[model samples]
Target: MPSKKDKGKAKATDAPPKEITQKDLEKLAKDVDKIASKVQHRQEKALAKGEPIKEKKIDPAKEAEMRKKIEAMVQALSNMEQTGAIKASGRKDMGDHKFWNTQPVLQHGEDVTEEGPIDPAVPRDQVQQEPYPLPKEFEWCEVDIQDDKQIIELYQLLTMNYVEDDDAQFRFDYSAPFLKWALQPPGWRKSWHVGVRVSSNKKLVAFISGIPAAVRSHKTLHHLTEINYLCVHKKLRSKRLAPVLIKEITRRSHLEGVFQAAYTGGIVLPTPIATCRYYHRSLNPKKLVECNFSRVPRNSTISAMVKKFKVAEQPSTPGLREMKPEDATQVRELLNKYLSKFDVAPVFETDDDVRHWLAPTPEVVWSYVVEDTKTHKITDFFSFYTLPSSVIGNDKHKSLNAAYMFYYAIDIPEKEAADSYDTARYTKQRLTELMRDALVLAKQADFDVFNALNLMDNSMFIDDLKFGPGDGYLNYYLYNWKCRDIKPHKVGLVML
Candidate 1:
């Protein structure tokens, strides 16, 4: 999925693209350098005056006009470098979604009163037999993730070209171990790890991947394909390879007897079944401020900011400990029951699913469970994953460690009546306590910040825990599936 404000640009044009020459790219780079210098100077001036870190009042008309111009400039440059094909434009209408409009996705502003697949499933025999034709210079290949050399190749491609923040101040640094953990979940397939390479040199240049999962949209259960890690080399943007990669992946998924797919983007496409906002809880305030990941208040000092975000040294929740393999069964039962309350959620049908996803993996993921001190039964569980970002142009700090909230389940008391207010209130209070413990643990692990989306019951703790809203929005899309809008609280799905 795309991050805030880095959603690249408009959909690529199909017409033969006028090749962007090296000189053209250099000129664009120079223009961006000038803008960046000016912005940096402004930031230094603000810091000198102890400026407030809040939006300034501005005329609506002027703000809108100014925003449009900035977006255009950023989009044009980022399109060649961004990791996702999403855009952060103000225009609600689809702009040259020539390919998406033709696909089975819901049209922009289209109403959905019913839920089901937008396109009929095709038989395996009828699916495309050969891969989609890549440009003559490039050829398709199945990346052997198990192969160290191949995985490293994929890692290098992403490390250089993956997502960067709106200001280019930070870029996600997905470790090789982390990539393996994410792409090789239970029932993963080599065929789904699609990649493209230069035909002559066999150099991996572009990639897109899919993984099988049992996702339920309301009452309809679909064994859908979760699409992710769509990346194209920066130089190949004008080659119109993104659509081709998507089509190829779709074809391969169809051949595997899967039709429907789920993906997310930062931009508004034809339609989105749900839109979630991001929230950030700073752990290392001093580091965040120095990296430009955050800013201090007008009258605040770095030490004050740190004190404001500090957490207790120990967890308040009794019996909470690191999750173990044996806890998978109990955790699975509790998680499934909790997820059932959501309109859209994953179905962890087996204990292996629980262990594979929720069990802790050092430095990559962390999971903990609360137990009944005497009963020896699981009471609650929470999990988060590590995803550090490279701090661009920061001399003191080279990276910012970030922990992302993954999934959790708690023992909600039985409702006395339908829609019981007391039950909801209790749920909020308990979640707040557990999540605060999570923050403490993450801080102990030396993370600089914790990030989460406003899905599930997260809203209950966000404000109480001092999490500020972020500029990014993640739009959840179900390809070939039509479902009514799902409220953020009713969404239980989380994508890596």
Candidate 2:
């Protein structure tokens, strides 16, 4: 993910040109004349001061050539604007994606029929042995996440300077325990937890990390390093450290023979294989409205809004229980079977990987399963993790407790399936029941809201569960790989 404070820059020029109006040409001419007059006046002042200003006289043909060149430059800039190089959102187009343009990602509007890496793999020995050079006074270091003090330092840095809502009303507050749980997953590498610190005071200013995963796209499965949590201090954004952090992490991953990476960001970069929207369900409508995280309807009263979103204290699922260590193996089999139906998904090779990601962790992750009472088989499961956001300047609430929906699965017997339509209906019915129970559990836990992306089969229950569409959109990117654009329903992998 790109840093919220320090996004990289780039350039592009393949767009077609738009016609330039005569009035526009006249305005460009006048602007050039004004610049020439300003320069002449500066030269005259230098001569009066005995600075011996050197002057060059332009012949008529040379002057015409200069004017023509200036017009061409103006036309190119105008073309850029017409092609959305300068967007209404104030984001630059693919041509201006300075950092991503140099990487192995696809450019905007590029089509793909065959999926493969944009760059071929290099031998491990050919990978960079030394870390990329940092700006003067800033040195690269591997963050020791196991140490409590170092983890606290990382926590503080992210809490104060990480991703925030556009209105600045809230900022992500990833807890210390959550950081450790996310960064130290299965196949984690200590060396991939890259950080930069100030040499003078030893203050950590920037960080980027990667964790190994096996991801399947279409018929091919690839081992990839999932990159995330990229952040830079607000004051150091001008130093262009975000790009450096990205390059350094990529180098480290390459040294381990991983050639492709996956990530998600709120902002658009060179290109995205899938774009997903966030949907939120209010658990505590009054708190959300008071904190400006949401608003009460203009026609509805606070009491009405609160009553509308209220959930039952108990879950509806009969055999639902918190997941235990023994449940990991069954959950992994169920999840992998369900995920295989998607176009892109993760490959959990062992029960350990499932336990690390889906098993319950107090105050960090909560997973539950529905077991068949007679057969004692795990038939369904769902999970959500805590990711609270600090409610900026809100006196009533200090933080908005949020539960983000994670991996989930439901068993559908192949022998009972008559056709695709019946299978779709069965899946929808099972997921809706499971998710409703999940929402009740979240409400009982005192979460202010429950959030989920419009990915996988979430579209089946989002509206039925009263989850309103969010303003944010997350774009999923694959580094060094090109794949056909996927719809939200076809995306099974979720990034932290």
Candidate 3:
């Protein structure tokens, strides 16, 4: 019998497993049926679209024997995975990853000494010609976010079925504007916004999206895709639709000549090129405590805890102000120069890209810049974006407003000299000063908390500024590419 767990094929649960029951077997049967329907649908879609469908001869006796063997193996594997003996990333062995092992990604426990694509790029003509087939009752649709109805459908689907915590006490609430900003960045392709919908009712049940990115790994630029927003309705997760969604998106990226990709997840998968810890600074401790998102320390009073985390009333930087459209060019230069120091970072090409990313959007993103009062040069800049988590089952609050630290840069003049130690100490002090003001700004905006990853120069201030380490760990993975592992300190790219 398979062990019962609530994790998706591509997701993991931090909770203890529940005992398997008859209901679990029935659900498993439906999942198997869904997959079978998709296999049948592939042939039909191939004939309809005039694409080749590689067929294998059916042998009834052999098929039945094979099916029994496969079922036994799957059941055993499921039990192992549910027990944490195996992992979503196939930690036990390469063979555990029936799907990932065949893909061009780094294998678990494989040491990476080189940095480059695992496979060379192929011509567009050799890429997949049609979307991956879905179950007969389901069809593929490419979302056009400009359409309000379509946006609303996506919003509704994710609002109900997206990322959730182990306790089911919180869910990510990505606003329509945030989705628009996240999905519709410069050079975004409509084709990459893949959706799986019920053919009978045209209701969306699954979705995965990819956006173009020129990510640099080990200072070598790779034109790749940043894959995100993978979701399947809770009712259909057992259908194993996530693998199909991933394959479809990868195929779509292939058609665009992008052979490499990047993604982040809470679950530990086949391999992580880099792992980062989540750190949080609570602004509204009372709200966090009320929502069970935080607990009062062993020997601290609520009033004392609140006072301990109090931020300054105003920003202390000399010329820090809201970033403007005109400052985009200067900020881009500063970012590019600063990010080059990292092993992995995004290359901000133009002022437009800077404006799109770093410019402030009311309630969506807050950006600030400090000017050199004498030179009028943009000396430093920092930004954070808003993402509110729904406080599930909380009687007092509906949402927990969070501000996530985004890209930032500090001016450490190379010519105006100091030793490495002194430079590092100075940089830390400058960033701490800047981050303190950022805390004040975020608090003023009524954010319940501010969160950041242990990446870039963030480590320099997290301790001095009193940010607490969070239990959540995020693993960063690169798809179809091989690269030496990046330490959290060298990760300069911030994915939304």
Who wins the lDDT comparison? 2
Tens digits of per-residue lDDT, candidate 3, 1-496, equal 0000112231245322445432354366446535554654575567558877786523323543443344334434443454466554444444576677778889877887876678888999998797888889999999889999999999999878888775677888889889988898899999999999999999999999999987888868978899999999999977879999999999999998888999987655677777666778989898889988889999898998899999989999999999998999999999898899998899998788888888998878899999988999999999999988777788898888989999999888764336764466568778999999999999999998988987898866887688875645566789987888777778888887
The lDDT values for all models are 0.79, 0.80, 0.79
TM-score of 2: 0.83
Model 3 superposed RMSD (Cα): 17.4
Q: How well does candidate 3 score on lDDT at residue 213?
A: 82
Candidate structures ordered by lDDT, highest first: 2, 1, 3
Task: Write one digit per residue (lDDT tens) for candidate 1, span 1-496.
Answer: 1253334232343311336532454466346435543554464456458885243433323533443344333333334333334334422234568788789988876888787888898889999899888778889999998899999999999877777765667777888889898888889999999999999999999999999899899999989899988888888776678889999999999999998999987656667787776779999999889887778989999999989999999999999999999999999999998899998899998898889899999899999999999999998999999988877788898888999999999987666225554566578779999999999999999999999987888966887798875656677889998888876678899988
Q: Per model, state how many residue pairs clash.
A: 1, 6, 1
